[model samples]
Target: MASERAAAAGVLRRPRLVIFDFDGVIADSETIALEELAAEMTARGAETSYEQARALFLGMSTARHMAYISEKSGRPCAPDFPDVWHGRLFSRYSTELVAVTGVHRTLNLLDRLGIDYCIASGGSVERIRFALDCLGLASRFEGRAFSAEMVARGKPAPDLFLHAAAARSTSPHECLVVEDAPSGVMAAVAAEMPCAAFLGGSHLDPIRTRHRETLIQAGATACVGDHAELQVMIEAR
Candidate 1:
């Protein structure tokens, strides 16, 4: 295995693969997702911020989130929550879900460096691919992209990222996960992989400090603001 520096310097490394969370890490799907979700909840008189929505749904499968909410609220989530939420999200992001500010640049750098990577998202495969396509990242990933929908469980359970690592033919310790939600950080940690939390639109502050700590406690080596820090961490490794 080449050292981390070697890998970042464009040399092949045994830990060649990086698994990314799509909604908040790569594409700005979280913003779009929360926007639509908030609006839906608002129409139902349950308006909440992205932070609230994220707190409620991040790292959980959309279907599972709805179910949890239904169980907790003791009221059925709209029978149409899945299709409506999914449809609203996709419609709002019909052509706007883009890679984060530094994501494309980092991806280009990784591509130039010959580092292999994949998307391991909590989103369904169809939703993940839809956003990736909007950002023109679909073809770039091709067969490397995977979703929680492929696994028996989602984040905080390790199934999704574990599936991704298996597909990439890498060991958990050899992989680095870039995520934004607590559930994702937990997922990576549960898989025995290093992870970094990205805090962007989640607007978590006082809680973000605690959130970062929780991530570290759960298994993330660090928490950062964006992919730029991630690039630096990978290079420094």
Candidate 2:
């Protein structure tokens, strides 16, 4: 496991491949999605708040999130819930989504440094592609985006990250994962890859310190305040 002390020391090995998480790490879309989920639950008579929704569902898979909603509301989610929810979410994403602050600069840095990078997100492939397209990053990540749907298990498990590494033909030790959630940090650790916990997402603005602590405890090798800090970390020897 990665130690917080080591992470705080600000020393990290430069990696050949950088694996980025999509929603909160690359695209500034978590706040929109969480707010929408809270509103949707409230309209369904569950009375959920944005904070509550974020705490409960931030890193969960779609099926797991629906199951959680059903358990919390004491009613099963409609069978078509995923489809309907995604449609609504994508509609909103088209108008409101933007890339995370400093993400483009960070990617440009990676390009100049000659590091290979790809997206390995918990979101569906379709969602990932749509978001990249919306952010005008589709061409940059072409043929390099991976989704959890392709693996047997999602975050908190090593499967998806490992699958991504194998597909990219990169060794786990040669990969660095950039994530904004504890589950993703854990997944990276379990995959034996170093992870930088990103705290720049708007959804984390109100709880950045707490989330940073949580992610460090979850085995992140470092905590980055934003993509600028991330670039510094990546540039470190």
Candidate 3:
């Protein structure tokens, strides 16, 4: 079909590796994340919504989130809030941050195809490990996961993804970044890596509206919502 050919053209001609973002892409944790953040914000008299939280807080570090909310609400978030919030969020995340739909199967497919891949996330190294361990995916990624905190700068900076690519021993141009946030897309662009934005979080529409062209203009060859379609694209490449 014409559509099939078009889809094929959208994929990389030959990719040496793939890198994935965590929070909204491979884990079903955004809704619960918003709830937790809202709870924390309520104590500070700030409002929250899945959309607002995703747009402003998700993919950001706790310190960044605290600073963001502080600026938004004009109130100082409790200094201990980060530790407490992290504890509460991790407890819930441990219980609820299951693998996203089809993620496990897709990872397996990639493994079967002998494709090199890694998780490049904005979360801390410990947090990334916790989620991977909870999902029993730790074994699949030995020396392959790199946290943003490990780099000089986080998302929108190109450090994390670039580090992951370096660990995989691949050129930036040959690596494909699978992301779910505008920041991640920006990071990919800054790294000069090809990217694909997967619309899966609460801010999906807004992120699409705001960054669809930015992503393409930033060097994303394609944007898609379905993981199956992404799998097909990768396989074709």
Candidate 4:
């Protein structure tokens, strides 16, 4: 009985909206992004492996990525670094990227369930659109995408998630965040939103268990392994 009450205290019951993180949650773009980013940094003399890149910059913007590269290389990245990355990444995205394995099907299910969802991502609006369009998800999220570029502070701060929730007319406690980055999970927690730490990606395989535990410790309400597991949690909630 005591244990049951402890579990009950953590339940959200029903949230009015779902906020998805872009790169790793809805789109399988993290691995692709990290690979290309690592190569880009290497060309600038800041060589890094995929694992290192992911560790150093999982939920940062392109500007931040370039800054890190510049810092590491001890030379500033070109003024056109953002444009350069956008062109390169988008070009490859057209032929190489896809949505998270079962996300389209999961979105369809959410549609059927009458649940409202929008994206709140650290990626720029243009980059988010490119990935979603590549995955044929543009129409579903047409006017509903929120970018960290719109806010003064990004992930690990509650600004972006709170902005997203406010734009959707939902309060923080009335939302659930599906996040694949520790910083994002922390943001959700700070916003008072229940977080579902997602471990459903090629990029997350190596540190999946460690990440899951870390997120739970960071105040995630749950840790889900795949879209199917997320769907189950969604339906139950």
Q: Residue-wise lDDT of candidate 2 within 65-87, one digit each (tens)?
A: 67777887899887776676678
TM-score of each: 0.83, 0.92, 0.85, 0.91
Q: How high a TM-score does candidate 3 get? A: 0.85
RMSD of each: 4.9, 2.7, 3.1, 3.1
Report the error of model 4 at residue 220, Å.
1.5
Checking candidate 1 for backbone clashes, the offending pairs are: none
RMSD of 2: 2.7
lDDT of 3 at 158: 89
Shift in Å, residue 57, candidate 4: 1.3
Q: Candidate 3 lDDT, tens digit per residue, 74-176?
A: 8887788766666777998777777777787778878888778888987778777877888888888878888877888888888888888888899899888
Worst 10 residues of 1 by lDDT: 4-13
* lDDT, candidates in the order shown: 0.74, 0.85, 0.75, 0.83
Instruction: Find the candidate with the highest lDDT and give its number.
Output: 2
Off by over 4 Å in 3: 1-11, 73-77, 200-219
Per-residue lDDT of 17-51 in model 4, one digit per residue for the tens? 99999988898999888888888788787888988
What does candidate 3 score in Cα RMSD to the true structure?
A: 3.1
Model 4 alpha-carbon drift over 4 Å, by segment: 1-10
The regions of model 2 sitting more than 4 angstroms off are 1-9, 44-47
- Candidate 2, overall lDDT? 0.85
Q: Which digits, one per residue and each the tens of the lDDT, describe model 1 over residues 1-237?
A: 125323433421235778888877777667678767767765655556667786777767876767655765567778777677889888878866666778877787778767789999888888887887888888888998898889998888999898998998888887878887878888987898877667654444347667666655666666666667667666654
lDDT of 3 at 200: 50
Residue-pair clashes, model 2:
0
